[model samples]
Target: MIETIFRTVDVPAEHRFEAMRENMTNVHAPAHLSSAHAIDFSAEMRLVRLGRLCVWPATVQPARMWRTPRLIRQSDPEQYHLTLMLRGTKRCMLTGRQFGPHEMHMTDTSQPYEVEVVDDHGEIKMIGVEFPKALLPLPADQVNRVVNRRLPGQQGIGVLLTSFLTGLTRHTGCYRPSDGPRLETVLTDLFSAVLAHHLDAETALSPETPQRTLMLRIRSHIRQRLHDQELTPATVAAAHHISTSYLHRLFRNHAHDSDHEGTTVAAWIRHQRLEAARRDLADPAQHAIPVHHIGLRWGFSHHAAFTRAFRSVYGMPPRDYRHATCRPAGPAH
Candidate 1:
């Protein structure tokens, strides 16, 4: 869910300074503004929580020179902030680096920094993502060098980074709990790609940590190659530049104690194939495809073996399972 904190500054000459100061302190506005005349301004901010990550969109108008304190506190459990300016211009300085419009900035609440607004007349829109320092895969020192530095948003890694943030914000509601780990992986990749473009050392993200990432990659690869007859463990491992034995080790590492690791992998593959075959069998739109062919299309080389495996997994043979699932029941038993 998303929570919003919105306030508008429309005080006349008498209260402009007080109103501006209150807003600056409350929202932690990154600029210092001094004005003599009365001002009318409004700003809307929304922060959406996604697991350990937070996405926020902010829009403000009625430009004023404002300075944000270096030791800004965060309500989030995360400590790092990444901001992308969507519209208007902003001059941000942190760790002795300056950033402008369409640029990305990283700020650590543990440190202090200053930002100045250059063109506040126009609508200023920004998207900020907050994450924990531990969640970041890059080394702290390497990541620190880029903090407050202006990264070009027009090309290369910046474009990809922006696109991912925009897409995530737009579709955050549709994401499910099952997708959390995968989403984290995607975010990690995007961050890595960004750091790589900047030529920063990523020793902090050493690949020896959790098995979740390798498993996710392996699953994605397997799904994509499910239809190919040559998509064995050796082929899959070679494609990923890992040895077949290591790939087996990864699968074994994740399997339950009672199941043979190879059998577990094979069972998962068979189950997916069976599910795809069942969908094809039941789809009136795909009525022309033969049931056996549908099974073959999903990596089942032998019809008898496919049928037996399907029955074992689904409690019925392939044809019977298809009939029971696809056809409407006359009445409940």
Candidate 2:
């Protein structure tokens, strides 16, 4: 237990990119940095070491891009980061997943990844838990299954995990030194449950747990493959090793299909696609990426179809929306 140790680091606005690079590599993982607007950046991180797990809350300004291969020259530690997006958004290019407020994202440091801050608002805040590779009960392959995917903070183990991580920072001053090991155990158990639930490896979990885990895994699968033109009910069902009819039953039991009268699986996928596209189109960093390209990036096949769908939901064309949201491009700071 490392309850006796608490540290905080900050990068002032005038410090520029090198300061950020130094801070991140020393405090978190080593990564390459980009963004001429880095001169506009500032950051702060508060860390609490809890045995094998470290809980930290970070707040950063101005959008930034990070790539691990940029500065890493030696062996990469097998560390996994479970991040809760407290405010703003993050898009992991490696998986094409975008995490919004109240969502949790798992990232493995061993793999080279590209992540960019997605909030147009000045800064982003998040609670991140960094733990050793073995601390996660599941095998490496199992962790890979959930990495880069958005885990909802609203329900199931996600809710508990999110609350616990955030509460650690909030009540750090109250915990006694003896609580470190206990806190470490709680962190491992909760996060392990979150991972097991998502991977459907809940064989040792309660019977009822598997059903909820299955539903969540189904939703994750749908979101992950949203860009695939061939993504369909049958494919999702097949991928899960369940019959197409049983898949409908699962969704029906979870209130996602016909007779249950909620958003159908297809509708949910469409909503996610549009939401992803909207984010990209609104991103200041994507100003030069073209409206149609943004649509295509999120799985829209036809320009006309993308435009119709974009206008249908937001009442504004993609072009107009980008024009309205993005600032004029200028010399990089």
Candidate 3:
């Protein structure tokens, strides 16, 4: 679970806004914050810290937050704040843009900017990440091109980054402290790809950035099409317009040998398919679905084949696994 480092629910309603404001400036960059509903404000912040990057998912009352020249002089983290709005609307004076749910906007903490909820009343829900400017792998001036600009999170690399942040918020406890460095790398690459795409500067990225970015794109493609029985390495390569050999090479270079032997493209595909089926088997809501149908849904052509694969990984047949984990369909207590 993501850690609730700061939450206003426990504080007196009259003091909740001030508590939130204090935590924000202390944990993030220095900024001035105010809310029209301070007397009855309610908010929550869930945070996860990766190496040099930190993500915070917040549910906050309508408020105005800004950094002025004076605030900048007082303190500057020299970080970039990328906010993915999950609900409500916001207006940013830095880019002269207004955005709402499923859209993203970025700001450089080194510069003065204003970000305020434009809604007359309601909570503004957003997930944000702050990372040092040096982690971007691009020149500061080039990165400024997107500062506070409305970015499309519904399509392209923006979708991947947004999905990643959303997943992290939901499953933060699934990770260990040792995972920080790798998670940091993945976030940096995805963030870099989004910024580079907007600037038309893909070639400006560091040598390792493109390879890591391509691997992520490939993994995403594979996951999306796992239901297709024809989703072989060759077909996957064709979809991405790369040769099958090159795809195999990419997998070999990036395979997680420390865990399982998913060193080949075919093995990776099978593993993902089995994992999907496993999740369905464990879901109580899906317990009524036939074991064979669950297998077929995830690209296993025959019941026996699915059983063998599932047992090989999970040490039990799908039906038995489901029986052990899922209770009979009935009313909740």
Candidate 4:
């Protein structure tokens, strides 16, 4: 199961910053943490354990954290820390870099570094993943080339990695402890792919990596185009330059690893479309949108078909589902 490693709200206000520092040290590596506004510090962090790799999703107050050469010698986890900035900016003097929203930075625990993250108006939101340096399939020299470098999270393999990280963080309840090994394999492959792509060292990845990475890319592609009415197995396969039969086999290859009911391409698309329409139906802000219109937006062309499909999965028609979850606006106060 995933863990909520820390929440400032659980600690006394005066001690929250101190608690955060201690938790960070334990979770990642030893470092000194200080904040100009420590009295009002607040944050909530969740730790998702994927086998030997761990991801930390947090929204924290402005603070400065640094590791010295002395601290590195004292206790080095010998881990690589990859951090994605979701909603703030951070400046690092050692790397001579500034990362804005949607950018990522990598750090080595064996080296000294310093970072100051801030958002003057609110808290800083970030997700960080740490794994043993030895777990990466590439050589240490190749890995060293990319450390302290800024990686963009908005494109290519980076998109796949960021999506997987954020999805895991947001839906921890959907996974079980037993799912750790499978999730870890996917996480490691994607991380390796991202690093390899940056270093022009794709050939260094293991033989199984390309197939797994391709599957992840296919899934990501399918998700982004779920709203299109033409989304189907053929269209999806064409986009990826693969045959439809090959796509089916790809899904078949991993059927046992997933708890999802469907493994075929058509089934996967239908499931995604239904889940998306279901969220829109339950959303209060979308209540003003008609049920059939919401269905159409997610590729369900017919009202009766949409109702039948939605009811089959959700145990109720879209209208009833909406009514049960969304209270009608009481007369505007």
| RMSD for each of the candidates | 9.4, 15.3, 2.2, 2.5
Q: Tens digits of per-residue lDDT for model 1 on 1-333?
A: 444454444455456555656655444434345532335445556655555666677776534442334333432233667778777666653334545667887666555655544444656778877667787777677777776767777676577677667766765665655555556555566665566568545344556433534555576677777888777777888887888888778777655321111334666565557667877777766665677887889898888988887787668887776666575434558
Between which residue pairs do clashes occur in model 3? Answer: 1-173, 106-148
- Global lDDT scores for all candidate models: 0.62, 0.74, 0.85, 0.88
**Model 4 root mean square deviation, Cα atoms:** 2.5
Error of 2 at 152 (Å): 0.8
Model 3 misplacement above 4 A: 256-261
Ten contiguous residues minimizing lDDT sum, candidate 3: 253-262
Among these predictions, the greatest TM-score belongs to 3
Number of colliding residue pairs in model 4:
0
lDDT of 4 by residue, 1-333 (tens): 456678989999889888898899989998999888788688888888888888999988889999999999999999999999999898887866999888899989998999989897878999999979888999988899998898999987898888888888888886878888888888888899999999999999998788889999888888888888898899989999999899899899976555556989888888989988887887888889999999998888899998998899889999999999986565767
Model with the higher TM-score, candidate 2 or 4: 4
Ranking of all predicted structures according to lDDT, beginning with the best and ending with the worst: 4, 3, 2, 1
Clashes of 2: 0
Name the 10 consecutive residues with the lowest summed lDDT in model 4.
254-263
Candidate 2 stretches with Cα past 4 Å from truth are: 1-16, 69-73, 204-333
